[model samples]
Target: MKIMIMRHGEAEATALSDGQRPLTEEGINEVTQVAELVAEEYVVSKIIASPLLRAQQTASLMATGLNLPAVDTLTELAPEHKPESVLKALASEEAEVLLLVSHMPLVDQLAGWLLEGSRMSPIAFPTATVAVLHTDHLAAGVAELERVFLAPS
Candidate 1:
């Protein structure tokens, strides 16, 4: 299976809470463009995102771009959580290509854990960045970092 880990699009700086922040217009456009790229190059079966507003919006954009019908929200994908729990939850996913949208630190950490089995995250994910990983068995250090698509400039 292939896991497409993505960081949410750019968001407003102020909100009642961080989770309430919505995507900026630029962010929406950029994510829409990137989603087009993804649709052109890959086959995505499922989209999972953090429950936060920006992430949810990003997932909705991605779902629209990919011609998908649903986006599943996982609380474990929130910024405050660690990668292990999300990874564990995703272990049972049978999709050929599964997409996950979340925030930094968690996105970085999850990519790091999947790539090297450590706490250090190597890639710097700009807003709406997507990292594709391939693995037969869902476990740390067993997945290969296939490629990464950066956010628009």
Candidate 2:
């Protein structure tokens, strides 16, 4: 299976709540370019995103760019959520290629958990960055980080 983890694009520093933050104009452009490039490289089957507004917007852009149906919301993808929960939920999904648009630390942590079996991220997860992993099953220390896509600055 191929799992792609993407951080939401640049967003307002503050909102009524963290979940309410929206993507900036530049963020939209950046993520759009990144998504288009990824679409060219892989056949994205499903898109899952955090419920947070910024991630939702990012996922919507990715879905449209990839010609996908719609983005599915998973609260477990929130910034503070644990990578274990996300992995557990994804284990039941049937998509051969999946894209998850989410927030920072969690995105980083998830990558780390999949590749190294630790909570420490091996790579930096800048906004609008996407990391690709290939694994037979979604388990700790069992996946390989195949590649990464960084949206133009």
Candidate 3:
């Protein structure tokens, strides 16, 4: 299966709470562009995103652009959650190409855990960045980094 781990787009610096922060106009534009690129480049079967406002917004944009079904929200993708949790949440997913929209640290951590099997975060996920990987098993150190689509700030 192919997985595309993505960081949410740029968001407001402050909100009632971190989870309430919304995407800025610049964030919307960049995410739109990146979503278009993803739509053109790959066949995404599912989109699962963090419940945070900004992440949901990014996922919504990508869903619209990709013509995918409604976006699914996952608390495991939250910034404070661990990659193992997200992996557990996705254990039964049957999508060939899955898109996971999440926060920075979690997305970076998840991708690293998927690729190296240990604590190693090699990819830097600036806002609106997406890294694609493939694996036969969900275990660590077995997935291959197929490509990355980075939407420059």
Off by over 4 Å in 1: none
Q: Could you tell me every candidate's TM-score relative to the true structure?
A: 0.97, 0.98, 0.97
Best by lDDT: 2
lDDT of 3 by residue, 3-27 (tens): 9999999999999999899999999
Clash tally, candidates in order: 0, 0, 1
Better of 2 and 3 by lDDT: 2
Cα RMSD, model 2: 0.7
Cα-based lDDT at residue 94, candidate 3: 90
lDDT of 1 by residue, 118-140 (tens): 75767789999999999887778
Q: What tens-digit string does per-residue lDDT give for candidate 2 at 4-92?
A: 99999999999999889999998999899999889889999999999999999999999999999888999899998999999888878
- Native-vs-model 1 lDDT? 0.92
What lDDT would candidate 3 get against the real structure? 0.92
Overall lDDT per candidate, in order of appearance: 0.92, 0.93, 0.92
